[model samples]
Target chain A: MTLTGEFFAFMSLALVAVIGGVLLLNLTKVIHMVVALVFTFVSIAGIYVLLSAEFVAVVQVMIYSGAITIIMLFGIMLTRHHGEEAEPKGGGLRKLLLFLGVLGFGAAVYLGIYDLNFEAVPNTLHENNTEQIGISLYSQYIIPFELTSVILLVALVGAIVLARKDDEKEGDKE
Target chain B: MSSVPVSAFLALALILFCIGLYGALTKRNTVIVLISIELMLNAVNINLVTFSKYGVNPSITGQVFALFAIAVAAAEAAVGLAILIALYRNRRTVNIDEMNQLKN
Candidate 1:
């Protein structure tokens, strides 16, 4: 197949996947929402394959679709409310405003891209992709990488602190 | 079948992203909102990979960054879900508006 044909095929598949994602996201139920997200991640991985980043594409599937979504599912299970009713009605006006805001944001991004001259940068991807990333992360971006770890640590600690409650009721004894 | 244009892929991604953003902002359910955020992030990854394919000689940076994004997203999911569990235990509700004890 010609290069153009290949590109078209990939793009069409991506479009279908994205539409499915949207459908899943709009559903009110949490389980279906996460399932749709799996489709979205897999499709985006296809985009990575089109870009010739095979390793990244595989990693996307393993990490996102495999790990992250399962975590979310467990969270849903853990937090399942017993005999609770459906969610209350949210404000329609607020939803309309949010929809408008996103539309405006998209238009602004499109306009910005339209006006600006995008000079395509050459040699954007390194041959030894994973090795280069490791070098950059450890050598140049070490501090920020470490900071991210610290942030995750803090988040972990915070989660524990917030979840734990003292069992003793001192006021009742008084 | 022929491959689609880059612009078409981007357009679809943008639409998906916008819908996710709207859902995230408008939905009161915490779980739903989190799903929307995931949608937005995936849209961004699509753009990065698409540009990497057609634009340059070496096209791996986008993919590398995407990998990192996925890792961070995993951590985020774990923490966010833990928080949701904690919140549910306390308030017995997952609606965003109701957990307003910190509101001034």
Candidate 2:
């Protein structure tokens, strides 16, 4: 096997994503975990670029790293007094069980992938990735697209409803 | 030069999924658990995009699916955090372990 720029890029991005994920797991501070998650999201966007999914890459960066991360930070700030103080509960047996479960799942997936023979087809790239995506999204997968929009609208209303202070209603009554 | 094998992408996604799973299971903070769920969603996105690129058809369908997944994930995160905020307001705690009010 020969080394190439693509391989090197993939390796670097994978390292970033994996390390960021590990940090998100290990970090005690909620804010720090969000920052680490941002790193992972950004690197995943980079990987999308390598996959020639430029539109997805941009969306990943704009949505995941930009919008989602900001929303999480805001959630952390508005909800908690000191967002950095929460620590994992100390339970030796529970921790061991979780560790074992996660490990088993990972090992199973790794073995499954290893044993499966997948033909590596040469990736075909389109000149206009965004156009192709838009065409397919609107035409072939139109229903799901519309449903996703509805889901977002519901989420927006739900967030407002769920987070609004209940005392506001009582205050208005007075 | 051989293009980055599809297996590499699979491996990356698998690693990410496991990490997310571990965090979701072990972390006491509700915020971290939400973030872990996002990580897992991202891993799924990676898989979708990878298959789209290297699959027999090599179509844009996978990317479209990934887009929908991203949107849904964002919505889920928003609602999840909102719920967390409301829970914190009533309970004064964000630790999942202590969120046992409904348990009894």
Candidate 3:
């Protein structure tokens, strides 16, 4: 296909994804927000597929849509009060200012990058990219990977400790 | 159909990321904040995978990293919700503003 046509297609998909994300953000009901977020993740996976990362796109759906969203839903179910009204908090002006500040910062960064005519080194996609990645991970990046595992282990322990009830302490005393 | 440009993918990821950030900052519910964080993480994954596909010879690294990220996110969700559950058990409130034990 022509570059112009491709750009138009991408633009449309991007627009849809962006609109979905915004809807997720603006919705007051938490459950609706979660549903919108699922849409956002799926659309992003579509973008990944369009970029030619079919493997990554599938993993995106498998993990984010399958696991993380379900986790968030469980959290919501555990936390939300049954049929209670959401409390109203007033800070509209401050929120608006913060939002505008973020927008300005983003615009400035984009413009600055655009002005700099940076050239990227072109690389072609290979069939054995996944194998190469595995080789590198097991060889050069193994230490960091191990460290990440250890960090996750520590987080798990900490979480369990934090969640432990003090009833045990009272039981020991008794 | 023509191939999609990398820029379009990046732009969508950026917008999703920003909205996630906004939700994280503005939302009071802990669950919502966690979901927003997941959104941001997914945005990063999209960028990594897109670059891997179009800009690199070995495209597998991005997907591998994305997998690692998914694992981390799952761990995070489990631990975060566990903590939230504990907190709810003790205080019966999930509002960040109300959980100020260290505000000396």
Q: Quick one: best TM-score, which candidate?
A: 2
What local distance difference test score does each model get? 0.69, 0.86, 0.71
Task: Estimate, for each residue in A49-79, the C-alpha lDDT of model 1 and write its tens digit.
Answer: 6666777778888887888778777777777
Ten contiguous residues minimizing lDDT sum, candidate 2 chain B: B1-10
lDDT at position B30, candidate 3:
78
Off by more than 4 A, model 1: A1-5, A81-90, A114-128, A165-174, B1-9, B50-62
lDDT of 2 at A41: 96
Can you list the residue pairs that collide in candidate 3? none
**lDDT tens digits by residue: candidate 2, B46-72:** 999988887656778899889999999
lDDT of 2 by residue, A15-49 (tens): 99999998987776788889988989999999999
The C-alpha RMSD in Å for every predicted model, in order, reads 4.1, 1.9, 3.4
Which ten contiguous residues of candidate 1 chain B have the minimum total lDDT?
B1-10
lDDT of 2: 0.86
DockQ of 2: 0.70
Candidate achieving the largest lDDT:
2
User: Which model is ahead, 1 or 3, in terms of TM-score?
Assistant: 3
Candidate 3: DockQ?
0.47
Candidate 1 docks with a DockQ of 0.44
